[model samples]
Each structure stands twice: as C-alpha cells, then as structure tokens.
Target: MKSFDVAIIGSGPSGASAAFELSKSGISTVIIEKETLPRYKTCGGGLVFRGLKMMPFDISSVVEKEFYAIDTYFSQKHPCITTRRKEPIVSMVMRDAFDNLIVEKARNNGVTLLQNHKVVDITFGETQTIHTTEGDVTAKFIIAADGALSPIAKIAGWKETRTIIPALEYEVEVPAADFERLSNDARFDIDAIPYGYGWCFPKKNHLSIGVAVVIKTNKKINLKEYYAAYLKRLGITEILKEEGHGFVIPVAPRTDFFVQKNVFLTGDSAGLADPLVAEGISNSILSGIQAAEAIIESQLDPEKAAVLYTEKLKTGILPEIEKAKVLSYHFYSKKSFRNIILMKYGQYAAEALTDLFMGERTYPKDYLKSITKKIKDAIFF
Candidate 1:
C-alpha cells in the first residue's frame, strides 16, 4: 500500500490549496482526482477579487475577464443596483483551466497527483485506507475536500446535517456577435428562481448562466425551466449548446463536525462555502490552508488536530457564513422583508456586498443590529 503524510480527495481549489501549503512545508502529500486533470468543472466561473488576491502564485494566464462593477437586479428589470469600485471586483475563468493551474502549482511544490483515480471506498483505523480504482493507499491524515455530496463524508459518517442546495450552470457558446452584445460585465438577477438567484457571468468567448434554488425553503423547483426563462429574459435566442450541468452547493458551514478520527473535512465536505453569495472557492482555499496549518500545529495528533481545526474554523469562515445566513434568512425565508429593505436601500446593500466580495468589508456579526442601527441613524434620526 502506498503511504504518505497526507492524502487529499478531489483536486479542486481546496485539495490543491492544501497540497500546495503542505508540500511547501515539506510534508509529503498526494491528491487523488477521479477525473483527468483539466476536465470541465460545473461552476459560474466567477472568482471575486478576494480569491484572486489570496492565491500564492499568479494565475494571470487563466483569467478570462475582470470586472470593476457588478450589476444586480431585482424581480423587476428597471430598478437594478450596480456595485462599482475603482478596482476589479470579479475575475472570470473557466474552471478547467483555473483548477488545472492550481494543480500544476501544487505539483511544482512537490505534491504527487494521481489523476483518473476514483475513490471507491475509505476505511478508518490507525491509518486511513483509501480504496481507489488504481489501488489502496494509506495516509496518516485524510483531507476530504471532495465537494458537496462528499463520498468520503458519507463513508466516514461525519455528519448528516448540511444546507445542501441545488444549482445549475450552462456554458453556452453563443455567436461572437451575440456573446459580445448580450454579455454584461457582471450581473446577478435575484428572483430568477424562487428563493434563489440567477447569474450571468461572461467568459472570454462564451457566457456562463445559471440559477440556484435554496432547498431549505422546501420549494420544489425545475432548474432547467428557470434557466430557459432566464435566457429568454436576457434575449438569448440562439445558443450553440443548451446543455446544462447540475451540482449541489453548501450554503452554510457544517456546525456538526469537522473531523472524524483522523480525517479532516475541508471545502464542501465541511460545508464551508459562503452563505451569502454561495461562493465556495475563496473559503474552500481558506479551509484548505487552515486544515494543513492545524495538522502541522497539532504535530499529527488526531484529537489535537480536530480541536485546532474547529477553533481556527470559528475564527476563520463561520462568522462570514453566519452573517450570510442572516441575509439568506431575511431574503428568502421572511419573504417580503428582503424586498422592503432592498427597495429602500438596495444601492447601499449592493455596494456593501460588492465590498464584501472584494474583501474590503466584513459582514457584521449581528447583521440586524448593525444594519438597523445604520438605517435608524440615517432615516429615523
């Protein structure tokens, strides 16, 4: 059995980031990827400037476009709010190229990548056993960065609690003229789907369009139909491929468990994606870094590593997620509350959200307290 200091499942941003940090520290690491490298990843391909700033190395070659403003729309078309800043807010890149670039960097840092290796099963004991199509490999530590419906988490019985929601994305290769004509800088259409949002993110040559539905709302949704309606709203009559891909995204951080015995959950496995924007790549990279840091700090003690991970996670990603959950709750659950507030202060909220995306502002711990204070001081006073 092949053994290593650490084994990472899934070679996306989280796993690759972990490998990069661990290998840089001289800890042997292996990344097990089910598919060959550079395969198409189902994402809107919108990376906020914060994620771009967090990367240790440059990925300029993979960046397709950068936007200084993001246009956000309400259920109606006319009263849209545009979040603008002097610096670029979001950078767009195809996930295949972007993820491959990160993997290459991790490889350069001495991480071994086992491509086309599907993990069939995993067994936990003194050392963790990863059963793959290639062979069984053992590692002292396992980083389950394996996406929303993580098989590793299922095998390990980490937690049944997660705010897993359905999202669909389509990379439509429109004609060059239509692509140019229809592509906006960055746009998010709220209420594109009930209790969720639709987005139109421009790539270099194509446009990535998608809709997400919040599952906790208990609303039965047809994502494909919503996507078609969105295309119509955008006046997209011609498309090279109407094919769409569906995947699950975690909106809230897992409050249940981050570790089971020797396994550490990062990324979607840990449910660490941002609750507000549903952005995983940024926090996924952050979780990967903290996971490696915890392992290194704990001196490989599973219990101590678990403690360190939880503590760091609280200080790391949970606060933002909590605030986002507040936003989600108000926006989706309480119904008309979101509309009332957005109607009154949509521009301010849009600007704040843009700054939040750019890492300029952090969401207050108690969103209602802070925001209400601001509203009262400004309006009532």
Candidate 2:
C-alpha cells in the first residue's frame, strides 16, 4: 500500500485545488480519480468571475469565452436588465479541460495523480486505508472532494441532509448566425420554469443551456418540456447537434458533522454549493483551500484541523449560504411580490448581483432584516 499524509478523492475543482494547495505546502498528497484526465463533466460551464479569480495561475488557455455583461429576463411585462462591468462577469470553459488543468498544476508540484482508481471502500484507522479497485492507499487524513453523490461521505457515516435539486443541461450547436447572435452575452431567464430559472451560457463552439428549480416541490416538473419551450423562446429553429444531461445539485450543506475520525469532507461532498444560484465551483475551491489551510495550520493534528476547518466554514462559507437561502426563498417563492420589487429596483439588484459575481461584494450577514426594510420602503415610500 502506498501511504501519504493526505488522500483526496475526485478530480474536480475541489479535489484538484486541495491537492495543489497541499502539495505547495510540501504535504504528501495523492489525488485518486476514477476517470482519466479531461473527462467531460456535466455542468453549465459558466464560471462566475468570483470563481475565476480564485485560480492561482492564469487559466486563459482553457477559458472558452468571457462576458463583460449579463442580461437577465423575467416576464415580458418586466423589462430585461443588463448588468455591465469593467471586468468580465463570467468566463466559460469546458469542465474537462478546466479541471484537468488544476490537477496538472498539482501534479507538477509533486502531488501523485492516481487515474482510473475508483474508491470502492474505506477502512478507518490511525492511518486511513482507501480501498480502490486498483489497490489500497493509506493516508493520515482523507479529504472527500467527490461530487454530490459522494460515496465517501456515506461510508464515513453521513446521512443525506443536503437539499438536492434537479437540473437539465444540454450542449447545443446551431447555425452560424444563431451562435454568433447568442454567443456575445451570457443570459438568465428567471421564472422560466416553476420555482426555477434558465441560463444560456455561450461557449467557444456551442451553447451550454440549462434550467434548474431551486426549491423542491411535490409536483412533478417536466424539465424536457420546459427546455423545449426555452429553446423556442430563444428563437432557436434548428439544432445541428444537441446532447442532454440530467444531474442533481446539492444547494445546502449537510446538517451532519464535516469530519469523522481523520476523514474530512469538502465541496459537494460536504454539500457546500451556493444556495441561491447553485454555483458550487467558487465555494468548492474555497472550502478545499480552507481544508488544506486548516490541516497545515494544525501541523497535521486531526482534531485541531477539524475544529479549525469548521470554524473557517462558519465564518465564511456557511453564513453566505444561509443568507443566500433566505434570498433564494424570497426571490422564488413569492413570484408576484418578487416581480413587483424587481420592477421597481431591478437595475440595482442586477448591479448588486454583478458586484457579487465580480467578487467585490458578499451576501449580507443580516439579509432578512435588510430585505424587510427594502420591502417596507418599496411599498410605502
């Protein structure tokens, strides 16, 4: 068995990032990935500016497109709001290349990359033994950076407490004119689906389009029907090539403990996706870095690292998600009232969202109080 100080599962942004940080600090790290490098990942591929800025090295090589403005559309009654910025608001990329780039960086820094190694089971002990199909590898700590359906989390005695929402995405290619027309700007259509929103993210060659319902309901929502309607709304007459993928997004954190024994959970494994937008890349990278830092700061003391990691999450990631939950509820649940508020102050809200995307702002600590005040002011004054 090969032994290391830390073993990280998955090769997405979270795992790659943790490996990169840990290897930079001279910690023995191994990234155990089930697939080969540059495997296609199902996602919108819209990397917000905030997440883009988290990259330590330049990723221009893999970036497909960068948009300086974002167009948001609601019902026809409410006008579309365009938010602009000096810097690009969102940069698009295919996840296969983007994720592989990060993992390569870590590998260059001496992190072992174990491709085609699927973790089938985990044996907990002083040194955790990760049993993969290929073989067994041991480590002092295990960082589960695997995605929403994290088997490691379940093996570590965690229950399903995260709010998992369904989403459908398609990689679509159209005529030159349609691609050129829609490729210039990133767009979002709120209320495109019941309790959800739609996004059209232009890539280098095709358009990555999708719709996701934030809040789960008892009603059976047909995403395909809505997707077809959305395509018509976009004026898309012909589709040269289209591939659809269905996946789930974990928008809330698990109520269970983050660390058990020496195994630590990060990113989707810990259910750290942004509650409002379902954007997990930024927080995934952040949580990965935080976990690495906690381990480093504690000098490899598992107990101390666990406490420090939880503290770091509470201070930053958790609170932001909580506030985002409040915002998402208000924005999606009360549709009529939300439209009213947007009709009055849509531009400001769009600008605020752009600022957040640019990493210049954060979700306010007391979002409910602020929202109430705004509602009162909007209604009376």
Candidate 3:
C-alpha cells in the first residue's frame, strides 16, 4: 500500500485543483480517477470569466469560443433585449479538453496521478485507508471530489439532500449558409420553457443546444421532446445526429457539514452547484482550493482544522449557494418569473445573474433593482 499526505478521489476540476494545491504546498498528494485521461463529460460547455480566472494554469489552447453579447427572451417578442460586455464574459470549451488540462497541470505540479482507479471503499481512523481497484492506499486526509452522485460520500455515511435537475444537450452541425442566422450577434439565447429554460450556445463549427427541467410529482417528461421543440423553434428540421447526451445537474444547497473527521467533501459532492443557473465549474474550482487550504492548515493544527474548514466554506461558498436557492425558486416559479420579465429586467438579467453565479457578487438585489429602474426610466422618459 502506498502512503501519502492526501488522497483525492475523482479527477474533475475539483479533484485536480485540490491535488494541484496540495502538491504545490509540498504535501504528498495522489489523485485517483476512475476513468482514463481526457474522458468526455456531458456539460453545457459554458465557462464564465470567474471560473476561468480560478484555473491554476493557462487554458487558452482549449477554449472553443468567446462570447461578448447576451440575448435573453421572455417569450418571442418584438423587443428581445440584448446586453453586450466590453470583453468576453463567457468562453465555451469541451469538457474533456478542459478537465484533462487541469489534471495534467496537477501532475506537473508533483501530484501523483492514478488513472483508471475506482475507489470501492474508504476506512477512516488515525490514518485513512482507501481501497480502490488499483490497490489499497493510506493517507492522512481524504478529499471527495467525486461529483453529485458521489459513492465516496455515501460510503462515508454522509447524507445528501439532492434536488437534481435533468439536462439534455446536443451538438449540431449548422450549414455554412445558416451560420449567420444562427449566430447573429455571438450571444447565447435562453428560451423560457414550460418548467425550465432552453439554451443555445454557439461553438466553432457546431451549435450546443439544450434544455433543463426539474423532475416533479414523480413524473418523467421526455427530454427528447423538449430538445426537439427547442430545435423546431430555431427552424431546424434535420438533425445531423439523431440522439443527444443527457446529464443531471444538482440544484440542492450545500451539505450541512463539508468536513468530518479526516474526510472533506468538495465540488458537486458537497452540492456546491449554483441553483439559479445550474452551473458547477466555478464553485467546484473554488471549493477545491478551499479544501486544499483547509488540509494545509489542518496539518499545523489538527484539532482546529475541521472547524476552520467549515468556517471558510460557510463564509466563502455556502452564502452564495444559499442566495442561489432563493433565486432559483423565484426563477423556477412561473408567476414570479413572469412578473420579473414583465418588469423588463430580461436584457441584462442573464449577465447579472452570471455575475452572481460566479460569486463576484452575492445576491444582486441591488443590480436587479437598478435594472428595473433603468427600464422604468426608459419607458417614461
């Protein structure tokens, strides 16, 4: 059995970031991943400015597209508002390429990378033992970055209250002639659907379109139907690919406690995803850094480590997630959303919402009010 200072489970952004930070701190860290390197992950492929800034290394090579404009529609109307940023606020990249880039950077920083290793069980004691497909390994601390459906958390006896929203996305090859019409202003569109919203993000050669809706009343809706309706609205008759990929985005609030004994939970495993936008990358990366900081601090004072970890998470990440819970409920509610749109905050709402999403501003009540006042001023004056 190999022994280390830290054992991080999963190689997504959270795991890689944690390992990178730990190794940079001169701690012996090993990152265990179930899949091979550069594995494909289903995502909307949107990375906001805040998330890009949190990366430990440069990611210019993997960026697929940069967006400066935002188009938001309440229902198809004459005055579909547009908001433009001076610089690109969002960049699109394939998940496989983005995640692999971080993992490679972690390895370069001296973190041992164990690929194709699935952690079957974890035993916590004075020293933690992680049993994996590769072999048994012991470490002083364990970090779980295994995502929303984390088996590690379950095995470790941590209860998670999950409110999962199902998302379906497809990549379509748009004909050259139709490119201009499909991407008029290089802005992504958010169509307010029945229970959720549909998004259209333009890529280099393809259009990434998707819909997300909450599962309600123990009922299952056909994701295919929702995706097809989005395409039909865009006047797309033929799809190059007949099928699309599906994934789950957790909209739940953060868990009660992020650390217990010798174990720490970061990223989706701790339900750090933004509730309003269903975005996880930014929070994942931020939480991963926080986890590493806690681990390093704990090495100095093991008695106060868990308390400090919880405090940092509460102050840094949980507050934003709490606000997102309220905002998500407001946006997801049909009546509230309609009232909000009627108030004319739709144009810059997405960008403002993205700002809050990236933890740049927690709860943009003031910004929303300013937007509402601006709209009122324009209408009267």
Candidate 4:
C-alpha cells in the first residue's frame, strides 16, 4: 500500500494545484486520477484573467489564445457592450494540456501521480484508506477536488445543497471564412436562452461555443434548440468538424460543513464556482491553494486544519461568492430591473465585471444598494 500525508482525488486544476502547493511546502502528497494524462475535460476552456493571474508558473505552452477585449450582446434594442484592457481579459486553453502541465509541475516538486486509479470507497478513521480499482492507498488527510458530481463528497456524507445548472459546449471547426469572422474576439450573448447566456471562445484552431442556463427552472429547457439558434445567430456555416459535450455547473456552495472527519473538500466538491458567470477555474484554484495552505499552517493537525480552512474561506472566497450570488440573482431573475440598470449603466457594468474577472477588484459589498443609489442619482439629475 502506498502512503502519504495528503491524497488528492482528480487531477483537475483543483487537485493538481493542491498537490503543487503541498509538495512545494515539503509535505508528502499524492494525486489519484481516474483517467490517463492528457485526457479531454469538458469545459468551455475560457480562463478568465483572474484565473490566469493565479498560476504560479508560465502556461504559454498550453494557452491556445488570449483576448484583450470582450463583447457582451443583449438584443437588437441594446447595443453590444465591449470592455478592453491592456492585459488579456480571458485566455483559452484545452483542459487536457492545461491540467497536465500543473500535474507535471507538482510531480517535479515530489508529488506522486497515480493515473488510471478510480477511487471506489474510503474508510475513515485517524487516517483514510482509499480503495481504488488498482490498489489501496492510505493518507492522513484527503482532499476531494473532484468535479461537481463529486462521489467523494457524497461518500463523506454531504447532501445536495448546490444549485446545479446545465451547460452544453461544442468544439467546432468551421470553414476558413466562418472561423476568420468569429475568431477575433470572445463574446457573451445574454437572452440567447430564456434565463441563461451563450458564449463564444476562440481557440487556436477551433471555437469553444457554449450556452448555459444560469438559473434553476421547473420547466424543461431545450439546450440543443438554443444552441442551434445561437449558431445561426453567429452566422456559422459549413462546419468541417464538430463535437458536443454536456456538463453541469454548481454555482452555490454547500450549506453544510466544508471539512468532515479530516477530509477536505475543495473546488467543485465545495461548490465554489463563481455565481454570476458560472466560472469554476478561478475559484477552484483559489480554494485548492487555501486548502493546502490551511493544512500546512496547521502542521498537519486535522482539527486545526479544518477550523483554519473554514475561517480562511469565510474571510476570503466565501464572502466574494456571497456578493456574486446577490449580483447573479438580479442579473438573471429580475429582467426588467436588470435591463433598466444595464441600459443606463451598461458600459460601467461591463467595465466593473471586467475588473472582477481581471482580479483587479472584487464585487462591491453593497452591490444592490450601490446600483440603486446610482440609478436614483441619475434620475434626479
């Protein structure tokens, strides 16, 4: 049996990031992955600037493309809102290459990688004995960095508390003309679906186009219908090749404890994706860093690590997620109100969102009140 101080499940950004930080701190760490390296992960693959800024090492080799300007379209009545920055607002990457780079970096720092090992069960006590298809591995601490449908979280006794939203993405290779026309910038089209949005991210040779329903609904949403409409809207024709992938995004955090019995939940397992944009990469990486740091600061004491991790989240990532949740409610639920706010302050809102994506500013604490006061002042003046 292999043994380590920490064992991380899933080689996604979250797990690999935790291993990177833990190994760098001289802690014994092992990464357990179900799939082989360079495996395809279903994501829109658009890394916002905030996520890019969090990387400890250069990722130029994996970066497919970068965009300094982004456009957000509402409808014909409202003009498209564009935001520009000197630095790239978003960088494109295929997850297979991107994730493998992080795992390789961690391996260089003495982290063990056990690929093709799917965890089936975990026995918890002073330490955890993880049962995988290949063999058994034990660790003093376990970090669940698996994706939204985290079996580890379920095995650890967590009930469903997150708001999981549906999204469909396509890796499309259009004809030369179509690719040229759509490849210059990334864009978001609000109202492309009933209560959701559509995005187009240009990559090195293809386009990662996706549409997501950001809110929960009782009625059925035909995402395929919406995606077809979106493609027509974008003037795409004569596709040389295309592939479709469907996935869910957990926009809300778990209401229960983040740490249970020495097992730590990070990334999608903890439901830490951004509420407004449904961006998971930035928060996932951030939470993994915090988890590793918490364990390191606690000197591997499970109790202290749990308390410290919760405290760090409350002070840092959790608060920002709370603020973004409020903004998301208004942005999606209140259509008329949102339209009014956007019509009057569209440019300002776009710039502010850009700042948030760039890691330059956080969501305002009093976001609702702040916007209300601005609208009131505008009306009076």
lDDT of 3 by residue, 315-344 (tens): 877777776676566555655434455455
**For model 1, how does the per-residue alpha-carbon lDDT over 192-301 read when each residue is reduced to its tens digit?**
88888899998887888999885366658899999999989888888886658999898876777788868889998888878767888898888998999998888778
Clashing pairs for model 2 are none
Off by over 4 Å in 2: none
Worst 10 residues of 2 by lDDT: 366-375
What's the lDDT for residue 301 in model 2?
96
Return whichever of 2 and 3 wins on lDDT.
2
17-114: candidate 2 lDDT, tens digit per residue: 99999998999999999999989999998888898888999999999999999999966578889999988899998999999999999999999999
Estimate the lDDT of model 2: 0.91
Stretches of candidate 4 above 4 Å error?
377-381
* CA RMSD per model (angstroms): 1.9, 1.1, 3.0, 1.1
- lDDT accuracy of residue 13 in candidate 4: 94
Which candidate model has the greater TM-score, 3 or 4? Answer: 4
The TM-score of candidate 3 is: 0.89
**lDDT (CA) for every model shown?**
0.85, 0.91, 0.76, 0.92
